[model samples]
Target: MLHEIVISGFGGQGALFAGQLLAYGALEEGWHVTWIPSYGPEMRGGTANCTVIISDEEIGSPLTRHPTAAIVMNLPSYERFEPLIAPGGVLVVNASLIAQKSQRADIRIIYAPANDIAAELGAAQMANVVLVGAMLAATGALQFETLDQVLDKHISARHRDKLELNKRALRRGGALAV
Candidate 1:
């Protein structure tokens, strides 16, 4: 199996981190994975994105012109990546940040209120994790349990205190996948 995913948003929105989590989960599942991050020079508040490719076999490259799935955390990301998803692919959009609706009919779209859900969960920064959860539910590219385990094993020491909160956000986002 193979899955190419893109997670995008402004810098500091955790797009790269979310992609890292997915890459970690893929690795935990014994899959060949590659994560490539790109950001504008402005850093925070500037455009940022990451591409993650997970495969059961060796991967030739880390880039994809049309990703099989995408998590867009802001309007700009939605605008940039929505048209790039492969036909019949899955897309998880941050409804709280994007005011416009998608017009595409070929791909499955999940309009998750990630920011609002994370805020409600007490950490708006976790909006990226929330979208990651939604992507898991919608695409099944990786097991949700794998993500939970990744959180436990790979979360940074500084954010260890919010592990439970992150899990809660994941579950909440997953629940919205339907």
Candidate 2:
């Protein structure tokens, strides 16, 4: 299986971190993977996006013009990547920030109230993690176990106290898929 995924949101929204986690999980699974991140100079409020490709076989290229899945955490990201998603591909939308709907009918769209969901879990800024779960749930691209492992290994030791919140955020977001 091959999954070309694009994750986009504002710079502080952790879009790059989400891509890293996906790459880490795929790497742990022994799948071929690549992660590329891009952002504007303004940082925080500026746009940030990342592309993650996971495949059973070697990837021919890192460039993805049309991805198999897209995780949009804001209205701008949604507007930007919605048209770039492949037909029948999974599109995880952050309904918490985006009130507009995608015009494309060819894609499978999943609305993830990331901010709301994270707030409910008491970590309002962890909406990225929420969208991660929704992406996994909607696309069946990765397992929560792997996501947990990635967090365990990648998240700095000093910030380990928040591990449980991240785990909960992922599980909660995954639950939204059902």
RMSD of each: 1.0, 1.2
Clashes of each: 0, 0
Error of 1 at 80 (Å): 0.7
Q: Clashing residue pairs, candidate 2?
A: none
Candidate 2 local Cα displacement, residue 132, angstroms: 0.7
- Sliding window of 10 residues with minimal summed lDDT for model 2: 36-45
Q: Candidate 2 lDDT, tens digit per residue, 96-175?
A: 99998877899888888899989988878789999889889888888889999999999768658889999999998888
RMSD of 1: 1.0
Off by over 4 Å in 1: none
How does residue 20 of candidate 1 score in lDDT? 97
**What TM-score, computed on C-alpha atoms, does each candidate reach?**
0.97, 0.95
Highest TM-score scorer: 1
Error of 2 at 91 (Å): 0.7
lDDT of 2 at 98: 94
Q: Please provide, for model 1 over 4-84, each residue's C-alpha lDDT reduced to its tens digit, 9 standing for 90 to 100.
A: 999999899999999999999999999999999875583998989999999988999899999999999989999999999
